[model samples]
Target: MRDNAFWIILQRLRTPLIVIVVTYAIAILGMVLIPGLDDKGNVYHLSFFDAFYFISYTASTIGFGETPYDFTYPQRLWVVVCIYLTAIGWFYTISAVISIISDKTLKKEMIKGRFVRQVQNFKSDFIIVLGYNRVNSEIIKRIRKANIDVVLVDHNADIINLFQLEESSMGVPVMVEDALLTSTLKDAGVNSPYCNAVISHFYKEEKNLRITILIRFLNPKVKVITRATLHDTIIAISDTDIAKVENPFEIFAKRFEIALTAPHILILENWIYKNADLADKASYLPEGRYIICGYGRLGKLIKEKLDKHGMDYIIIDENNVGTDEMIKNETFICANADDRDVLLKAGIESAVVLVAGTQNDIDNMSLFITAKKLNPDLYVISRVNTMKEISIFEKSDINWLFMIEKILINKTSLQISQPLKHSFLKRVLYKDEEWGTSLVNLLKAQLGDNPQLLHLTINEEKAFAIYHVLKANKPIGLNILLKSLANWQNYHKAIPLFLKRNGDEFLLPSNELLEIGDEILFACDAESREEIELIASNIYDLHYVQTGEEKRNWLLSKVISLL
Candidate 1:
């Protein structure tokens, strides 16, 4: 508790403490100066102890009879002087104490002290979040939902207080300081071993980049996830240890492309995410002229993807200034999209797909509602960046609502925490059609209608492993590995998804050969995942597998040979 603010308060009290000490000293000295008078006006010697007792009683206003003798006129005058001097000293001291209690700086420091104690005592592994903006708020919600601990830091005092009020029960320790400061990062325990991830979701791109550099230097093992809106900023941290850089517009364009091409997979994805209703699966992007409202980064990305796919589309923006020549050629009308006149001029009445990619949520909603009114069958895709006006999008029955913050957080978290699983999903479930079907079949067979993505890792709780074969290791052919795995998984339901040899990936090929330096990915519901690990690690012999013989443990065999 004795931090800088504690010292400051103590410094302020120095004056009052000095006042009290000096006042008592002077009063005692005065009492001893004038000697006490005895009977018949004779002078009596006054000891220091007797003078102390007299001054103590006088200062406290509990005056009693003199112990040694009665007081004379001069001594009585000194006693009166001591009483007022001590009273003035105490009054000043009490005021100072009250002033310190009500001081804003002192209260803030006290809060910080409590936060520091709580963080130091926190037992669970936590993620350090750098900002407390709208995006970070959604991220915080999801992090808490996963029952993960969070340490929050922000520069705004009011926002911190608001968060403390809202999430007080979660016991989230918050630090109100500039996140770019290394001292602030250290105070948040970013360098601690338990701090697995640092997510820099600051509003400014520069702060995120600086935090990325700082975290990589401070603790290279701790993964960093950041968001960048500028192209140059994204490119700057691409080769660094910053594992994830979330760009909302880029992600939106990719998802948009999926909606246009493989709408079924997009529907399945939304169902898995639980972001939209699955019953509207048939109402994917309809085939007709598309209307794109806004000419900003988000709008441009969607249009570029559409142009690459040879789709017809029209763009409507408020101004033609600073517009790219190619984009200007596709601009249907250089007018306000919210105006009904511009909507009519852009053929919104017959448009099948309408995308509201504007920065303003209200404007996006207005354009969306206008398009729906013009063409009720219009496939509406709207962007919502903030939580303030989400009800408008919800009540309008829009086909797709792209919450930018939610998407960014999901993308970043996937890359940081479950990179392999995300890689598998992004590569197979979203891209390769045959592999996507194979995965869907796997999930359907295992989970039926409640298909959800799961990872199989070789932690204590789960029996799973990912390993790369080395040249020095024995080369166990794929046929032998599969036969042994199949026999072992009879009780454990384990299956290998793919094998990466060199840079080529082979998915579930029964005849594929295993070689040195091949990486494998596996998934299993039971403890059979360990069987594959043993098979890949050269624990089982092909002869023992071909016949019904017990296989020697490779670890024990190596130990025996060493002996």
Candidate 2:
């Protein structure tokens, strides 16, 4: 790509360069061939060097006063011709150069070349995001805050320009190109070993699938996190192990289910993702009749979950074109959900839950307000289509708000950047209420309201001290890891949330012996996390934490032995 940019420059300037050379050569040749007179008034012809020097000044309009001597008529006439000839050639060349500089194709190639170089020079891991919108911009902000580099690909020049104009300390490379092309992916460093993952949360399912497919062939090892709304598209993406598909509607539905059945699990998820503090009281759904408005994708998913629990519910949509066969019994209403008549028809006055699940934000708000007017005690869940009207929704009387963009951004970012936390949350969502309550209480007591998640792998690169000790056949239990570096008897306020050893996972693993290749995920305060890192990586700290005796240096040991 770099070579291509250089070749483009050379190709564009080929004619201009030739014209300039020809004009200079012709001007110099004319000066030498024409006869001239020296101060002695003798028939003397200017040498090659002298003629070239004279023409250099004359053509440039410098006019060094007819170098050597006064020129004859023919010599002067040729000089007149040379002035216009050289000037015209210079003007033509300058215009051509300006045109090349302004060429959109050349500019794109140059930018691409620079982007490729930047991606190549990346020393740490980075993620390639496909689009640059409100959702992706937020995702980029979160990912960059974790100190990971990001490469963005979008076809909209205005959007790219807006991104560039934003004040950001982290350097993000943006490429304006079609993300569906193979070259675009290759240029975005999909094949780079440092490339951690590629994120494609495009609105179109086809684009996301195409990006996933291209990345699979480009770099099979790099993880591909993409979005798919359609069930068939999700199934197609599932065919590859390298791709992780995210459906915001499905995720929201499952979360709603968890909130209804096990609110503690939802609390744990919120705490882990930093969405809510542990100090906040847990909010759960009421078990009663539900009136769901709009039978779109999100509405359908919500209905499926409600049906799974055998809950009584009725769907109110503007039209019931394809829902006749699916919805038995006159439970489906063909009327606008925002209308007062529709709310009364759906028995909103007696319903315990009302979901404004339409595709329009205004309609959802109107529906919720009218439902509240009918039954202020009803628990309302509103779906937000865009972030522009978020303030309106927040101010409204909706009990639970779910925005598709936020759901997609948060889920996709967490899955790509913090895989361990993501995995832990997925497992926690399926656990029973009792188990979730116990775990949540444990975490809150130990780590406080908000805890930082830390991932550690016992290897030469991550935990040198632990790795060497385990390699020497020395056993290290989980309790030793939890011990504070300052005092062996005092333990750090940290708890292991998940542990992986030899392809097996143990949640909340107790004081079991840890091997060299074990991976542990811990939730603790920032200070405790830092202490844990020191204990695992520093030999002296590890020794102190384990045996209450600090390990001495070689020089001190030698002196003690001598004494």
Q: Per-residue lDDT of 429-493 in model 1, one digit per residue for the tens?
A: 45633444455566456534333333433232232121232233544455544454445333334
- Global local distance difference test of model 2: 0.86
- Can you tell me which runs of candidate 1 are displaced by over 4 Å? 31-77, 122-124, 180-183, 191-193, 213-222, 237-240, 271-284, 320-332, 339-345, 412-430, 452-457, 460-563
TM-score of each: 0.74, 0.93
Tell me the spans in candidate 2 whose CA falls farther than 4 Å from its real position: 1-5, 38-42, 68-70, 321-328, 557-563
**Which window of ten consecutive residues has the lowest lDDT sum in model 2?**
319-328
In angstroms, the error of model 1 at 428 is 4.2
Candidate 2: count of backbone clashes, pairs at least 3 residues apart or interchain: 0
The TM-score measured for candidate 1 stands at 0.74
